[model samples]
Target: MKARSFRFFAPFAFALSFSFLSAAPARAAGPDPDPWFGKDKALHFSVSAAIAAGGYGVGSAIFDARGHALLLGAGLGVLAGAGKEALDATGYGDPSWKDFTWDLIGVAAGLAVAWTVDLLVRGTGDTHPLFTAPAPGEMKSLGPSGLRVVF
Candidate 1:
């Protein structure tokens, strides 16, 4: 096509294409448009994990029992997630079960990591260091005395 004809055709074609796009039905906004794996979900997960791990460390320091520490960590994590949801329910933001689910998963992951670190640092035996030899009297309990393994 000639330069002049090409210029005229180009504008007409562009306008025609846009007209078709505009004719399509518009999407209605209701629930969140964010995907499950979006940045928002990542933030939620990371924040909950940090909270839970911090709580676990603090709880471990305050209480001798691992169970108490576990409860503290899980409670803090759950409280954080639930609090956010409750705030969203109050019209502060969009409430999402997906975000809460991610938060729960993060909490679990954080607790697992913290628990592993504790075990490594504190050791399951009388000695604090994981690689060290067990105390003399403690060696007697090493065998299959009331121990069970499941696959």
Candidate 2:
């Protein structure tokens, strides 16, 4: 009886978790088509990808539902990306869709990395990635070379 319950619960948990994670990135305001297409785009892409990845990791750790975590993370990442874009558009920085796209990509990458790592770790034991807000300095690359600050 115990084993039967476990079996049913496990699949339900997995399905629920996956549904949430997969839907996260798509829930954000549709990507702005105008700004995500041009110059200095690589920077934007990298940032977004990192945000996604970071958010997934943190989200998974805090929430019982894996999907919820992914959703929250992706949502936060999109907000960050949009904020950056809006700032640039207002002449605060360079408005580059390239950058926003990169941010999204970062979020995705973060999610993938976190998920893969979590799966591998779970098989060995019940460990998850550490979660903490990234330092301000950790946010962007420095100089024309786009070198990240390592600490």
Candidate 3:
């Protein structure tokens, strides 16, 4: 009973303490409450970008359509950004839309890069493997000395 009561009241007590602390007089000189290009925002952007790129790779392997893969990557990035903001909203950290915006930008950039690389790998044509097959009857073998051809 005692432990349960403590657990229940602890959060309230903690919240009340913050309220008291915040009640202190403000100073004239201070940093912005939330800057658009802060370190935290940069972290959010980079992490979202990585998530998007990874999602794109996985999606590309799973889906034959490039558009579908792009959608999956974008969806994953948005979900990650929103999830983080949701966590912040739950009193864990400062929640700001600016961070979400940066995350979105990062997602776009990551997707663009992945798409470009995919295109480059596929060549000018649609869905071509990186290595093209040699002409018939030209045997190619892999040995200790690397690729060897027997004409």
TM-scores, all candidates, are: 0.62, 0.50, 0.63
Rate residue 103 of model 1 by lDDT. 94
Question: How would you encode candidate 1's per-residue C-alpha lDDT over 86-143 as one tens digit per residue?
Answer: 9998999999999999999999988889889998787664333333433333422224
Give candidate 1's root-mean-square deviation (CA, Å).
10.2
What are the runs in model 1 whose C-alpha is more than 4 Å off? 1-32, 126-151
Q: Which candidate number maximizes TM-score?
A: 3
Consecutive 10-residue window with the lowest summed lDDT within model 3? 125-134
Pairwise lDDT winner, candidates 1 and 2: 1
What residue pairs clash in candidate 3, if any at all? none
Over 1-151, each residue of candidate 3 has an lDDT whose tens digit, in order, gives 9999999999999999999999999978788889987888889889998889888888666544566668889999999999999999999998899999999999998898887887776543333323233344655444567665432
Candidate 3 local Cα displacement, residue 88, angstroms: 0.5
Model 2 residue 127 distance off true place after TM-score fit, in angstroms? 13
Instruction: For candidate 3, give the lDDT of residue 39.
Output: 85
State how far residue 148 of model 2 sits from its true place (Å).
Answer: 37
lDDT of 3 at 130: 32
